[model samples]
Target chain A: MSRLKVLLPSARHLVTEELARGVVERYDEAAVGEHTVDFERRLDLGGFDDAVSAVMASHDAGDLSMDGAMAEAVHRQLRLSRREAADPGIWRYLAIVHRPEVVRHRWEYRSFATMRTRFWRHGTRFDANAFSRWWWVAELTVMAEDYSLTHRALGSSALSTHLFSRQLAWHHPTVAACVRILADAPGADVERTLRVLGKMLGLRVAEAMGREELEGLVRAARG
Target chain B: MDDFGTDGLTGGEDEDGTHFRALCKDTLFSNKREEGAGGSYGLGKSVLWIFSSFSTVLFRSTLLETQGLGNPRLIGRTELGSHALGPKRAFQGPGWFGEETKQRRGTRAESVWGPAAAEISGALGFQARNDHDTGTSICVVGFKDPTADADLGPVELARATRAALAEYFWPSMALPTRALTARTEAAGQEVEVRPHDADVAPFVTAWESYLRGEVPAKAPLTKPGDMTVVEVPITIPRTHGGEPEVKGRVALVVRLAAKSSEPRAGQVAFFRGPGMVVSYRDRSRLALGMRPFHAVLACGRGRWPRKPTESDLAVESFLRMSEPPAHDRWEPTPRLKAHYRRGYAKALTELSRRVDEALKELLIATHVMGERGPERLQRRFPIGKAGSPGKGRSAFGMSGLDARPQDGAWSFSGAIERKAGEGPWSVQVRLAEVDEAGRRTEEVAIEALSVTVDAEVVVEGSVASVTVPADVRVVPFRGTSAPCSFTGALELELAGRMVAG
Candidate 1:
C-alpha cells in the first residue's frame, strides 16, 4: 500500500501576494524529489497528463455521473500506477504546474480566494484541496472490484457528504457500504436515513465494528 | 466602532454611492467598468457572502439628506444556492430592515422592517451619528467557521479576519489619510487592527517614503549600499483624443550584503495614481550584476483623474486597457507595450548600468583585484612558447633529439623567472631557419646549457649556459615540429632583461 503524507500549514493564514510570489519562486521539481519519501517512484509527467485528460473527457461526457465515484476512480488509478510516489508534494505539483487550467475551468465561478485554497492546500477537511478530496474519498470508500457501490453511494449527496466529511464514518468500509446500499433502495429518504444512522453509529460504533457486524448494524438501523 | 462615533453609516446622500450596490448583490462581473478605478470584476466582494453561514449579510447606513438631516437605513440580503428552498420557489433574498415607506411623487412604496431607525441602530450597538455624521457599516450574520483545521470557535475567525485585512490593505493603511480602520469584537473585548506594526515595518516605511517623493536609502531586507533615484516620464495615449504625460521616478537601492534575505529585492513595484501599488515586475531578469537590489516606481496622481468624469473614465479605461481583471499584473497592450519600452525598460537599464559601475569601482577601491592578479595574468597570457617547424635537432646532444650531421644546428629555451628583489619576468630565445629560396620558413626553441655565472660574461661555445634563478618556470614549447629535421641556417636571439648573477 502506498502512503501519502501531507503537511498541513502550521497556521491557517490567508494566501497573500508575498506568500504566492514566494511559493512560485521557491518551487523546484528537484527539491520536491528530495523531500519525497518515495524518490524512486516519481510520477511521469506525460503519463499524468494522459490520465488527467482521460478523466476530464469522461467528466465532460457525463459518463462519470457520480462525482464521488469519479473522484475515487481517478484517485485510485493515479495512485495505483505510481504507488510509491504518493505524497502531498506531488499533489501540489500536479495542482499548480500540471493541471491548474482544468481546476480553474471547474471552479472559476466561485470566489477567487476560495479557488486559491483549492489549488494550493491539501487534506480531508472541509476546505481541503478539491483534487485531494476526490483521491481520499475513493481511497477510503471503494473496495476491491466494488466501485459500482461506491458510485451509487456517491450519487446520493446525503450518503457521500456523510461518508467523505466524517472521518470516522467512512473508515469502516462495511458500514459505509451498508449505508450506500440503504440509500440506494427505492422510496428511501437518504437525508433522514443518514441522520438516523449518523446518531446510532456515532464514533464508537464506527471504531468497534468489523465488516459483518457493521453491515448488521446498518440493517438494524434500516429496520 | 467607537473611535469615529456619531459619524453616520453612509458617507452622504449626494455622494456617488452606487459602488456599494455591487456588494449588496451576489452578481458575477457586475462591476466591470471601462476605467480600472471601479471593480475590474465583481467576484472580490463575494468573500463577504461566502463568509456567512447563511450566505447573508446585513447593511446599515446612516446618511445625511439634502437638508443635512440624519437618515439611517438597514437592509438584509442573502444569496443561497439554487434549489436551496425548493425546486420551484427561489428567494431573491433582499429585505429592508425598517418600516415600509409610503408612495410619494415620482417614487413607489417600499416595504421595510417595522422598527424606528434609532431603535434598530441602538439595539445593534450601531452608534447613531449626530446631524453632521455620515458613514456606512456592514454586519455579516452567522459567520461560518473560517478555520481550515479543527473548529476553534469565534476567536479564530476574528483573527483570520484581522490578518486578511492587514495583509490585503496594508498599502491603504500606509497612506497619509489612513483610508480604513477595522475592529473586531471577540470575548467581549474590541481590538483595533494596526497593519503598520513592526512585522511589516519595512513595507510601511517604504510606502510612506514613496508617498513623500523620497526613496529610502535602504531596500526592504538589505544593508545600505549605493542608492540611485531617477525620474522616468510616461505618456498615456487617450482612446478618444489627447495624450497625457506623467512623471514617474525609479529608485534603485544596492544592498551592502552579498546575499539578500528579501525575496522581493530584485522586483520593481509599479504604482499607479495616488501611490497605489498595482503590480510588480521582476527586473532581475535583466541579468544585472547587482543581485541584492530593489527598485520601486510610482506614477504621479496628475496622470489619473482625481474624481472620474465621463471623459476621465475614457482616459482611465484607455490607460488600463492592458491591466488584468485583478489588477495584479499588466498585460501587454499596444499602448502599454510602448509605455514599457519608453519608461520601464529604459529606467531599469540605466539603473542596472549605474549599479554595475558602482560595484566595479568598489571592487577596485578595496584592492580586491590584487588577490586575483596571478590568476588573471595566467588566463590572459598562457605561459607557453610556440614555433613552426617540420623538425629540429639538438646541437648540445640533448636526450629526445637526434644529433644532426649538419653545418648549423640550433636549440633555444625560455622560462619565467622571479628574482628575490624583482617582479616576475619572462625570458625567451628563438632560432630562425632560412630555406634555399632565401625565405625564413620555421623557428625552433633550443635548449640552454646549464652554467653558474658569478659575473656578467659572454660565453661563446657549442653549449650556452645561463645561471638558474631560485624559482623559475620553464615555458614549454608548443609547436608541431618533428624531433629531427634540418632545413636551413639557425640564428639564436634572446629576449627579456637578465638578472644580475
Candidate 2:
C-alpha cells in the first residue's frame, strides 16, 4: 500500500471569503475533488460511509454500546487501508465533502465561526475535526482485540475528548487500560480525574509506570 | 507581598478636604469640556452595588487634618435602597459607621448608624490609621458571585481576575508614575499587577516599543496647521466639487503574528483625549495583506471645545459625538460616521502602504542571507521575455519589480522557440551584476552553461530543425560555484532575442 499524497492549498485560499461563505452551503463533491490533490490508493469512501451509517443507526436505536465499537471499527479499517487518512486535510475533505450533512446535524446550533472550525485542521484536538476524532480516540484508547474497554473509557464524553484530543499517549496501551478502568469505576468523577491525570502527565512521572503502577497512581489520585 | 501602598482612591479628595463630599455622591459628573470631570459617567461605582448581594459597601476612610492638630477622622458609610417596600418606608442606604458626635446632624444624623467606625474596622480585621495615614478602603458585604456559571475555582478566578485587570488597565499601569495601584490577593498571598506582568507583557512591550520609535512612526501631514497630521490622499466623491481632502495622524505598532485560534494579532484602537481607547477595530476590517499591525488615531485635545456648541458637538473629538453609553466603543451618528469614515479610510490606507514597504525590505534582507538563498531570491525579481524594456512582470502580474537588490545571485529560465521550417535556435544566458542601488556595476558573461532543447538538432546550410522530445532540460544551470554576492539579472537569448525569467 502506498501513502496518500494530499497537497495543501495555498494559505491565501484557505481564508478567502468564498471559502468562509461556502462552509454553510450544500456540499459540492466535484468542487471538493477539484481542490483536493489527486493521489493513488484513496480511502474507500463507500465503506467509510457505510460504517458511519451503521454508527448513526445504532445511535438512533438508543444502543449506546455501539459508539466506541463503531469508532474502533473505523479506526481499524482506516489504519489498515490508507493510514495517511490521519492527515488533517484528508479528514477535512471527508467531513466537508463526503458527509457534510452529518457535520451540520452535529453542529447545528454552533455559530458560523465555530462551524467553520470543524472543517479546518486545528492543533492536537482531534475532536476539532468531526470524523478524525473518532478514529484518533479509538486508536488511542482501544485495547488490542478488546474494544469493550474502549467503549467503557469513551462512555464519559469529557474524559474521551480530553484524553484523545489533548493528553493521552497512543503508544501506551497499559495507560489506556488503566484509565479505562478508572473511568468505568462506579460513581467516578471522570472530569476531575482527567484533570488530575492531565496535570500529573505534564509532570512526566507516569512515563515509566506499568499497568499496575498506573492503577495504583489512579487509586492514590482519587484519594 | 508587602503593602507598597498606593496614592489610594483619591478622585475627589483634596488636602483641605473641602470637596470630599464629591466622593460620597453618586451622580453624573462632567467638566467644562464635557469630559468626565471626576469619573466618567459616575456609574462605574454602581457595578459594586449591583454585584453586592446585599446592595451595600462598607466605605472607610482616614482624612488628613487641615486645621489645628487633632486625631484624624475615621468614617464608614453604607448606601442601600428599600425598593421592595413602599415609598414611606424607603430608607437612604447611607449610614455613618463611626464615632457619634453632635456635629453629625441633618442628613448625616438621619443616615448615621452602627457602632463606632474603629470598633467595626477592628472587628472586620481592617486597620484603623491615625492622623498620618490618609486613604479610603471599602469592604463589599455579601459580595455577589461574578462567575456563578463559569464554574471557576478560586485559583482560576484569581488568574482570570489578574488577566482582566492587566488587559483593561495596562495603559495606566504602563505609565512611569501611575495614578493608581492594583493588587490581587490569592491563597493568602498578594501579588501586584503591573504592565510587564506575565498576563500583559506583550501589550506593554508593544506600547514601549511604539514610544521609543522602534516601531513605525506616525507619518506627519503636509498641511500647515498647529494640529499634527498624517494625511492619506483618497478619492471619495465630494458634494461641493472635487474630492475633499481628509487629514489625520495614524501611529502603527506591529506585533508578532498570532495563529487563528489565538487572540487577535492586530487592531486599530481609536482614542479621544487623555489616551482613553474609545474603540478597538480588529485587523480583519482593514484587510491589509501584511502581518499583524496595530494602528491608533487619537483626536487631538485641542480639537475639542471647552464648552460644547452645535459645531463643537459635530466635531469627531467631541465627547458625546461617538461614545456609546459604556464608553467602550465609538458608534458615530450618521453625520459623524461620514466624517469618521473619511479620516479612517485615509489612516488605514497610509498604514497599509507603510506595512507593504517594510515587508519588502524585510523580504529582501531575509532572502539574501537565508538557506538556499539563491533560489529564494528569484521570487523577488520579476520574470519576463527578454528585450521587453523597463521591469518585468511579477508572479501575480499586479506590478513590476521596482529594483532588484545587488547582493545576491540571480537565476533565470526560459524556452527556445523555433519557427516552423525556419531553423533550430541557439541560446545564450547573459548576466548583468548591478551595485547595491541596482545601477549596472558590472556586466559579467556566463562562465558556464548547460543547455538542452526539446528537439534533435539538425544544421543544414545554417537552416536547422528538430522534432521536440518528451524529456528535455531546457536552459539548466548546473550548480554555479561563483561567489554568492554576484547580484544582478540573468537574460536568456534565443535566436538573438532576449528572454527573462
Candidate 3:
C-alpha cells in the first residue's frame, strides 16, 4: 500500500497554504483536510524518505551538489506522472507533511513569508515551493528516458532559472530543445534568448507545437 | 442574567447615547466594539426581534451609567417588514415604544423611566430582579420558531433554550474562574443549567481538563473526557504596504466523546479569545473507525493559555478581521482585505486544513497512525524510472542508443549488439501515455508508425515487435515513433526476449 496520497481540489487554497505556512511549525502532524484514498492511488514514503535522506546527507557531506541529485531522487522515488507533477498540493504534502525536514534542510528557514510561498501559494506558481521547482525542472528537460539532460538543465542555478522562468520552457519538448541550444551555443546569451522566446510563446500556444517547430523557434531566438 | 449591569441605556444623554440608539434603531447601527469585547457586528441584538413573531421586543434595565436620569429604564423596539397599519396609511418599517415626548423634536417616542417603568415591567410579566442590579430585561413579545409547529409552551421553549445554551456555551459554563452562570425556567419551575448536563458534559470535561492542564500537547485520549491539543499555524504575510509578516497558531482542542450517538460528536466548535462560540463545524462524514469526539478550535487572546505575545495578538487581529458579518467562519472578507494585503486568504485555508489535519490525528485509530501507504504502491512508476536508462541496466539489447525528435516524430536509431555465444532475440517497443491522474493510460493504437530495420516487424496496438537473425553481428535500425495524436506525455516501453542460437 502506498503511504502517500495527493490532496484533492489540487490548487493552492486555504488548507493547502495553512499546511504550507505551518509546515515547519507543525511539521510532524498531518494536515486536517480531505485527501484521495482508493480512487486516487497513494504513494510509498519509504523509498522517498530514503531518497530525501541521501540528498540531505549529500548536501551536508559537501561536494556533490544535491539540487539536481535531489531532483532526480525525488523524481525517481516519487514517480509522479506528468499530471500529478502539476498539482502544487502533492508537492506541498511531500515537502510539508511527508518530508518537511528535507525542505528546511535544503531551502533553510529564511522567514515565514518564504515558508508560505515555498510550501504553497495561489495561481500558476510552481516555482515557489522547493520540491515542485526542482521536480518541474527535471520534468520539462528530461528526454525520452534520460535525466542527463535534466542534470544539465539544472547544471547552474542561473541557467536553470532562465529556462524554468519561461512559459515556453514549461512545455517539455520546447524546453528540451532550448536546453540543447544552451549546450550548443556555449557563448550565447541564453537568458535573453529564452526570455524573448517566453514572451513570444506567451502570445502563442506553445503546447500545440511539436518539437521540430519549437526547436525552430529556439534557433530563431538564438539570432 | 444573574448580576453585573454597569452600562445601561441612557436617554436624552449626548455622550453615551449609542446604547439607546443602537438598541432601538432601524437596524443595528453599532459597528464599533473594543478589541476582545464579548460582542461583535451588533447583528446579535436583532435576533431578539427576529425570534419575536410580533417583530416587537421590550427592554427594562436598572441604571448605573444613566443613574442621573433615574433607577430603572424601560423601552420597546419593533422591526416590521413594511406593512399597512390601516387601509390607507403605510408604515415603512421600524418603530419604538416607551413614552410620547414633546421636548425631542424628531420622533415623539422615548424610553420610560423610574416608578412608571417598574410598574409597567411588572404588568408585562417580566422577571423581577434587584433594583440595585444594573442590567436590561428583553421580552420578545411573541417568540417565533420557523421550524417548529405554531406556538410552543413556555416549558418546551425553556428546555430547548437550555439545551442550546449547554451545547454552545459549555466552555463558559464550565470555566473555573466563573465566566457565566445560566438558569432556565420551564412550567414555573426554574432549573440551573450546569456544565455537567447531558449535551454539555463532554465538551465541559474537555475544557475543564484543558484549563486544568490535564491534557496539553500530544497526550493520548483513551477514555471519556480525555482531550488533546494541537497547535495549527496561521502565518499572515507582509505586503508592499509594509506590514511585517506575522506568525501565529490556533490551538485545536479535541475530546473523546463518551459514545457513538453523542449530539456534538464529530463536530468542532471554533471560538476566539472573547470566549464566545463563533461557529460549529460538522465533521461527521470524515470520521471513520476513529473514536467519536467533539473539538474546539480556540484562537486569539481570550483562548490563549498564558499571556499573549505581540505575534499572538496579531493572529487574533488577523482572525477577527477575516470573519464575515455573520462571524461564523474565518474567510477572506472585505474588511480583512482592506486591512491586510491580498494574499492573507491562505490563512483561512490553513485554518481549515488544521481542523481536518488535527481531526485526522485525534479521530483516526492509534494503530493506523504510523501505517504507511497501501499495498504494492512502492513499485516504481511506469514512466520515469521504470523503463528509463540507468547504470548496470543489464536488459541486454541496443534499444535507444540515440533518441531524439526528428521531423515532428520520435526517431530511435540503435544497433542490435549481442556477445558471442548469445542467442537471437526479439525486441519489443511500445509507446504509452500517462493520464491526468499520473497513471499510465491503457495501451491504445500505435500502428501508425514507420519501421526501418533488416528484420521482419509486426505491429500491435501500442506495441512493436521485431525479430533479428542470430547470424547478424550487428544490425543498424531506425524508426519514427507515431502519427497517432497523443495529448499527454508519452514514454517508450522496451523489452527483449531471447530466441535460440
Candidate 4:
C-alpha cells in the first residue's frame, strides 16, 4: 500500500466543482431561488450533470450490478466510454461504491429500508454521485480484458468480493474462481480433487476451454 | 428534532461584540447574460451556506457584451432558518428546521459572522483566498460538520476519508495526499495514485502456492513468464580463417535441492538451440519439470523460432556443459549414505563441483548474498580414531575384565594401580583384526594388558583421584597415586555408545 496521504482538501474542491455543475443542471439560477422567475433563460448543462444523468440512466437500464450499470452510466455521461475509462485511477471511486460485495446485497433482494439502514456501512455513497459509483464498480469487478467472464461469475456480487488486501483487488476472475471451487469442494477429497484439477488444468488439453465451459464444469461439480 | 435554543447555538464571541463574518464567493451567476456559460447557475452559491452560517458572498463578473451598469451583486443571506436538504431528506421548500443553512450569504460583517467562519474553517481545515480581479470569494463561518455521518475513531475516520477521495475525485484532487490538518505538519504531504495496468493475478497465484508449501525452493524468484537468454560464444578462433566458428547454441540449466518426499530428480539439465525451434522443442516436453524450465530458457533466447535438433553437436556440447561432472559428493547423513550405491560417494563428489558452478551463476544474477560465499568445491570428509571390538586386557597382570554388546547395549571393566606423584597415562586395549576382511577379530579384555605406571595416583580413603589435563583425550576416571601401591577394579556400564576418542 502506498503510504497514507490526505485528499480531503482535494476532495472538497472536486466536490465543489461537481456540485456547482449539478446545481446548474438541476435548477435555473439566473432568477435566484425561484426556478420559474426566468424560465426562458435556461443555461446549457455542463458535463458534470450529463455525467450524473448518464449514470442514473445506466442504473435504470440493466440488472447488471446496479453499481456496474451506474458506472457505465457515468462513463457514458462523462464521454469517457471510448477512452481508457477502465484504468484503475479513473475507476477507484466507482469500485468503492459498486464493489462486488456491496452489489451482492442489492442482488439478494434486500429491502430499501434495510439497505438504507446499512447505508452508513454500505452503498450510501451511490446516491451522492452515480458516475463516481459506476467507475468504482467496474474497477472492482473486472480484473482484465476478459471482463465478460468476471461479469458472468460475479453477476451482482461485485461489492461482496473482498479484496485480498484493501489495496489489491486485481486478480483474474477465472483463476480466482478456479481456486475458490477447489477450496470449497467437499470432504478430505478436496486435496485429491485439487490435485486432479491441477494436473488437468496444467495439461495442454484443457487450455482451450472458454470461461463458460469452465463455469459449466464448476456448476456440474457443485451439483 | 428538539431545538437547543440559540444559547449554545451561535459560534464564539468577536472582539467588538459583533459576530465575525467571512466573505463567500458564488461561482454561480444570477444574470441571464451569463447563463449560457458552464458555471452561470447560482447553485454553487448555496454550498457556501452549506459550509457556513455567517458569511459574505462576493459576486464578480467580466461580461463580454454589456447591457448592464451595476454588474449586479445579489449578496444575500440564507441563514440558519433557510431552506436546506436534510441528511436523509430532499430539498423541496424553505423552512426553519435549522439542520443546515444551505446557501445563506449575508451583506457584510454582522454580530455573528467572525465566529462562524472560524468554526467552519477549523472543521474543514481549509483557508480561503480571494482573487480580486474577476473570480468570486465566499468566506464562511460557523460551518457545519461535513463528516457528521462518520462514526470512526480519529485515525479510522482519516483512513475512510482518504479511501473515498482516492476512489472518487482522484483526477482533479488538488491535494493528492490524504492529510488531516493536524498531521500535515509532522508527516509532510503525499499523493497516492492507483496503478495504471497492474496485473495482480500472478502475485495472488504465487502467494497461494507459498501457503500450500508447494512453492519450489527456486519458485520465489518466479516472475512474469518472459523469454530471456544468456549468450555464450561457440567459436574458438584458429589461425586458419576458413570459418572461425559461426555456430553457437543457448542452453538452460535448473538446480533443485533433494527433498524428503521424493529424491530430487538428480540435477537435471536440458540442451537446446543452434537451429532449435518449436517442433524440436516438443521432444523434450515429455520430461516433467524440464519443459517449463526449457520454455523459460527458449523465451529468453530472443525471437528464436524453432527448437534445436538433438543431433546438433554444438547444442549437445552446450547441454553437456550444463550438467555437473560425474564425481561431486554432497555430504549426507549416515541413513542417506546407506541408501546410495557403494561407489555413489565418489560420483556425488564430482556432481557437487558442477552444482557449485551452476549456483555461482544464480548468485551472480540475483546478488542473493554477497560474493565469496561458502564454496562447496573445497570441502573435505571427516576422519577419527575407531573404537574397540573389545576383549579382556591385562593391566600389571591383573585380569578378569569383559566388555560385550547385547540387545544394542554393552559394558566395560578394568583395573588400575595407584602410585605416588606421577601423572595418569591412558592405554589402548581393543580387538585387532587378524583377518583380511576384518572379520577374525578378538578383544584384549585381559590379554596384552600391563601395569605401565605413568601417574602418581593418590588414594583418598576408598577411591584414588588423578588430575588429568583439560586437553587430555580420555573418558573420566578416578584416583591419583599415593605412596603405597594399591590395586582396584573399575566397572563401567555402556549402552551401545561409540567411542570416538
In the range B132-220, model 3's lDDT, one tens digit per residue, is: 67767778887787678777777777777777776666666565554444444545566766658666566667767777777668665
Which candidate number would show the highest TM-score if scored against the true structure? 3
lDDT of 4 at B213: 37
Pairing residues by index, what is the TM-score of model 2? 0.40
lDDT of each: 0.45, 0.44, 0.63, 0.29
* lDDT of candidate 1 over B1-501, digit per residue (tens): 232333433332223344334545436645444344534556666777787777776666555442343355566666654323357644343433434454453322121221455567668666665544555566767766554656656776666666665544555556545544444555666655566563333444555555565653321222343343444433333222334433333333232223446645555555444334565555454542344444444333312224434443433443354555566654454545544333433433543465444333222111000011244332321222222211232111111111232334333322323322222222333444432222334545443333232212223332233433324423222111223344333333333322211
Q: Give the per-residue lDDT of model 4 (tens digit) for B1-501.
A: 001111111112122221111222222332212111111223434566665544423222221221332221112344433444567643332222111333355222222223343344334433332212222223344544454774445455445445543332222221223221222223354334331112222222222232243444322222223122232323212113232332443332232222212221222222122211111112222322221221212211211323333223432332222323220112333422333324333433433344333333332111011112122210100001122222332111212334343333323343422111122232323322111111222221322122323333343343333333323323322211212211111122111111110
State the fraction of real interface contacts model 3 keeps: 0.00
Error of 2 at A146 (Å): 67
Which regions of candidate 3 are displaced past 4 Å?
Answer: A1-223, B1-6, B10-17, B80-93, B104-107, B176-186, B222-224, B238-243, B257-263, B282-292, B305-309, B359-501
True-structure lDDT of candidate 4:
0.29
RMSD of each: 31.9, 24.0, 27.0, 39.0
- By summed lDDT, which 10 consecutive residues of candidate 4 chain B come out lowest? B376-385
The alpha-carbon RMSD over the true interface for every model, in angstroms, is 51.5, 26.5, 11.7, 32.4
Residue-wise C-alpha lDDT for candidate 2, range B1-501, written one tens digit per residue: 111133322333222332234444433433223443213444555565565666665555554433332322234445644232355644455554444445433323311222355566667656666545655666666666664775565566666666665665554455565434444444666556664655345545665555444543332211111011232222222212333433333333434434323344455445444555555656543332233333343343312313333332223343334455576764434433554444533434444565444332221111000011233334322233222332222111111112222334333333333221112223333344432122333444433333353444443332222333323323222212133433223222223211100
- Model 3, A45-93: lDDT tens digits are 7997887787788686322256778778777777878776776667766
Q: Which 10 consecutive positions of candidate 4 chain A have the poorest summed lDDT?
A: A1-10
Q: Give the alpha carbon lDDT tens digit for every residue of A1-223 in model 1.
A: 2233333332233233333333343334344443334324444455445655666665753333536544654565575532533455546545554455445434433455665676566665434565665666566656775665556655655566555555344464654655546656643555444444544543233566677776765666565
TM-score of 4: 0.17
Model 2 chain A weakest lDDT span, ten residues long: A11-20
Docking quality (DockQ) of candidate 1: 0.01
